[model samples]
Target chain A: MTVYEFAKGLILEAGGQVRSRMDESIQVETKSNPNDLVTNIDREVENYIYNSILDTYPDHQVIGEEGHGHELTQLEGFSWVIDPIDGTLNFVHQADNFAISIGIYKDNESYAGFVYDVISDTLYHAKKGEGAYINRQRIKTVEQTTLKTSIIGINPNWLTRSKSEAIFKQIVADARSARAYGSAALEIVNVATGKLAAYMTPRLSPWDYAGAAIILEEVNGVVTDLLGNPLSLIKPSSVIAANPQIHEEILTHYLSHHNEDISAFHQYLNSK
Target chain B: MTVYEFAKGLILEAGGQVRSRMDESIQVETKSNPNDLVTNIDREVENYIYNSILDTYPDHQVIGEEGHGHELTQLEGFSWVIDPIDGTLNFVHQADNFAISIGIYKDNESYAGFVYDVISDTLYHAKKGEGAYINRQRIKTVEQTTLKTSIIGINPNWLTRSKSEAIFKQIVADARSARAYGSAALEIVNVATGKLAAYMTPRLSPWDYAGAAIILEEVNGVVTDLLGNPLSLIKPSSVIAANPQIHEEILTHYLSHHNEDISAFHQYLNSK
Candidate 1:
């Protein structure tokens, strides 16, 4: 089967597994901190995706939020990036607002990606050349609107921290409104589907944004760091995925530091 | 039919009607201002709700967000308060995050209340003296949690406005995280179901919160204004709906003004 077809099948099956397990008493554990949680469902789902890919492809590499793949020094061949439950806290606590995200990249180029909002039964997917879609209908990114008329997604916790807090607070004040759904993939997909104009956060891992990043980009959205540079797939960094027009507007006006090009930071990822 | 029975039937029916129109192109119109929109669907839904209630009980009064009822000097008899689409913006834009909210009040007391999230098909309902429920399962308000560990629902727009900005920013900073769903009813129900520890917005009309307020109250939550007083059913005011334990905590610590009760403001309703 083609990688896209295989991925669609695996995601639907894993989503079914997640739905069925929602009612059962889940076994939960903490990682890193008390608030950060992982349920057995996450592990099971990640394993299912990992096994399904490896069983068929045999040579493809997989990187997962649950640590499913090898620790590699370089990206090579077909690489799968997945976050089994992007909002594990929402899943464990509210039984909703979480997503199963998977992105398949071949040799550093976007190939296929899918972000399934499990509870809502909504599927957002895209291929390299094919346009992004929510379920079956094709979607385009929202029109470029100024900060005063846009609805952006921003986590409230970001306000407390110092790094980007001051800058983000200004954006929040200038924007029409802000939202934080707790799931990065879902928020990014919301922007792709025109549910939100933009979504920004200070930190995120590859698995957290891989799937939605491609989908957003497919919809003519700009996926970049806070300073309007392409995001690095190997490491976590600040992210601002917005429509093409607002991407530069926000970067030059809202996110820029003294009119300096922030491309210097991205050199680290290329050197890796 | 019993009031509760009649309400349940109409809510589901209205919800179905709303669902059917989801795909059809909707004509939007502005109400008080540019940001405040009243779609053809809102008027249609409000009219349907008004006609349904009045048709059943001529003696009963109906007040709607779309301005269906009369301005009365006295609180008397059975009254139904409704917001056809609680999150109109979400309904018009996202088509998933909005809900239908209805509250039944009698002789100044909260009676039967319902907030149905149409897209998710989740029903949150409650009747006075019985219990609050989500669909069929009985729901209890969330347990007491400190601000440091709580997840709050606050509109980012509120952060930009000055009246409550300083205090709300502190709450946002103190809380573990913040979420802005853009729907008052959904956020209030989220608090009732423990998905959110508290939900606060400085100004919302009666129809915006009437129904969810009853549900939250029945679930052992405290539904009040910013001043820690029971919200006036007649006028717009700052709202803070929280668990019983933290209601006073938030009002006193996060939303208080010089340790004085703001009940004096309610006199305006009496004077009217």
Candidate 2:
């Protein structure tokens, strides 16, 4: 079987575990702060994904949110960027709105990505040179979507005192409506599937968007930093995932006007 | 069976139809504008609920979002306030995040309320005297929650030059996070179930928060206008649903501080 199919199976399995075990007791813990939460399921899920990767492809390397494998300073050959529980707080508190995100990088390039919204039983996957699909249906790029009539995913916390606070607030005011599901992977997949026109977060790690980046790219969706910079799978940064039309509108009109605070913008964008 | 039990079954069945028939093609139409949407499913579901109420309790009065039954200028005995589909846009686009919200009133008082999130198959319900429940588990009133550590449901659209703009922005900033789920029923239900500390919209119709109001009140959760005034069952007004602890804090601290703009706030709060 192709590595992509194997990854898909692994994602579905992990998602099944999450869905089945959600209502049971989970030990919640804090990572960076009170808002940043982790649970035992997160670590266990990471371990499960890591073990499967190692057992199936012994040479493949794994980078995870929890320490489950050798930490790679750089993205080398056949590395998997995995977030066992992308929205751990949501998993712990709400028992929903979380996903298992896996991005397989081959030779330092995007090869395949899978973001499984566990509770909804939706699997979004894509392989390099192929196209993205939500379940079995091939996804299509959005055309001529205007920002004024678009529904965007925005974390409202960024509206206060961030370097892009003004810019972000303007976007929120201009956009049709902004929603925050508190899950980056699902929000990115929302754009890929045309459910949301765009989604932006001021701070997201490599594991959060790596898998979604590939899937969205395959669907002709745009994934980049909030300032329209290319994303790095080895570094954490702000991500703005959108279809082609809205992506161009946001990048050109709202994001490009803020040249004065480029340094502060980069700091806040990469801080998380 | 009690009217409350009868309402519960009716809601679950209505919710079942919404869940099962979600994928089918439905004609979409604009209400006030393009952003305000309604579908054939919305009318069909409203008709189903109205017919069920009429057949079971012909003496009862009903007020629905769609023109389904006799319009009530005043709330009398055994009245049901139903929004056939809350978050119709979410239903049409995302196929999730929408719900069937029913508020049962008797003699001008909230008797029972039910909000069923269709895709998730989760039911939140409460009677006036009894406590609130999610599915079958009784939800408790949250204690000692603070704004600094609380998650709030806030619509960013109010950040424009409205009277409450400054107060709303401060609340968004002071709170740990602000979320906009685009469904008032689910947002209020989120507060009732302790999933969120507080949720408010500048304007909501009677049908939007009627059912949720009963549920919140049952758990000793607070439901009020932005200025802490009691909500009216016969008119559109601002709705703030919150846990027991932070409700006082938000009302006393942020919402009440804007006494200077009370008239303007009143005008904006009920404009929708």
Candidate 3:
């Protein structure tokens, strides 16, 4: 089987396990803060993916959110980044709106990506040159949309506490509407499918966005850091994913004015 | 058939029509503001529901968001309140998060309620004394949860523009997480199903919350205006729906401190 097919199989299998075991009681622990949650299922899923990768491609290196995989300082040959459960708090609380994400890279370039929405039975996947698909249907490029007529996904907390709160608050006011689904992977795919014009956050780990970024890119959507820079494969950074027009509009009209505050915020995140 | 059964049938039929017609090109128009939207499908669904109700119960009065029904000064006799498409913007854009909502009232008392998530094919329904159900399974009463550990659903725009922005912002910070699904009926049912501990908004029309209120109450949840006042069946009002403990806590600890501001906001809404 091709590497892309194998990755898809692994994600589907992991998603199946999550769907079946969700009814049983789960053990949850706090990570960075009380609200930052992780569950036993997350660790188990990560372990299964990691072991499966090693058994198939013994030389492949894996990095996952639950620490069951290698911690690489840099992307090397045949590297995989995975998030076992992208929205752990949603998984533990709502029992839905979470996904298992897998991104395969050769050296530093994206090769394939998969994001499986466990509850909904929807799988979003893409190969480097091939286009994106939801389940079996190929997704079309996001239609051109304006900021005033588009729905955007953003965490409400950013408006209340982030250094760029003023700028974000203005965007929220100007947009058609705003939603916070609490899953970066799903939100990115939402943009890919034209369900949202844009999805942005001030800080997200690579595993949180890695897999879905490939899917979004396949649909002609743009993914970049808040400062309009290419995302770093190894570091947590602010992210904004949108169709070309809306992306350019936000970066040029709104985010450009808050460069210093955004820079300081990025510095604070990196220091932490 | 009982009134509850008839209402459910009407909702399901309307939802089915919505699901089938979703792929067709639609005509959208702005309502109170540019962001406040309505569509031809919304009008079509409302007309279908109103005619269906009148055909079955000739004496029943109807009030709906799309204005196919009566505008009573006070709800009298067998009155039906409905929002044919609850999240019009979601219906227009995402085509997924929106729902069809219907509430049957005997004078001012809630008799039955239904909120049908068209895309997911999930139906949330309840009779006044009967417990709530999603599709076929009966839902349990919301578990006891502290505000610090609970997720909430709220419009982010409220944080930017409402009179109680400070209080709402503080509550958002204290919660586990916050989401905005852009549908009041679904958000209220999110509380009913224990997916959200609470959902609050500064202003909403009667059609928005009418149906979901009964479902929530049947699950031992609380529904009240922002000032802890009983919601009017004939007018727009601020709304807060939550499980009992969180509802009481939010009112006593957070909202109580800002009565004048909230009251003034209510007055402003009333004047408008």
The candidates, ranked best first by DockQ, are 3, 1, 2
The candidate maximizing lDDT is 3
Pairs in clash, predicted candidate 3: none
What is the lDDT, from 0 to 100, of the residue B131 in candidate 2?
87
> How much does candidate 1 score in TM-score?
0.90
Query: Please, what's the RMSD in Å of model 3?
Result: 1.1
lDDT of each: 0.83, 0.83, 0.90
Per prediction, the TM-score for chain B is 0.93, 0.93, 0.97
Cα miss at A270, model 3 (Å)?
Answer: 1.7
Candidate 3 wrong stretches, greater than 4 Å: A68-70, B162-164
On the 0 to 100 scale, the lDDT of residue B49 in model 2 is 93
Residue A245 of model 1, lDDT score = 72
Clashes of each: 0, 0, 0
- Interface RMSD for model 1 amounts to 2.0
Model 3 chain A lDDT-worst window of ten? A158-167
Candidate 2 C-alpha lDDT tens digits along A71-162? 46677789999999997767765667788999999989999999998887988899987888889988876545788877888877777665
Best by TM-score: 3
Cα displacement (Å) at residue B265, model 3:
1.3
TM-score of each: 0.90, 0.90, 0.98
Candidate 1: TM-score of chain A is 0.93
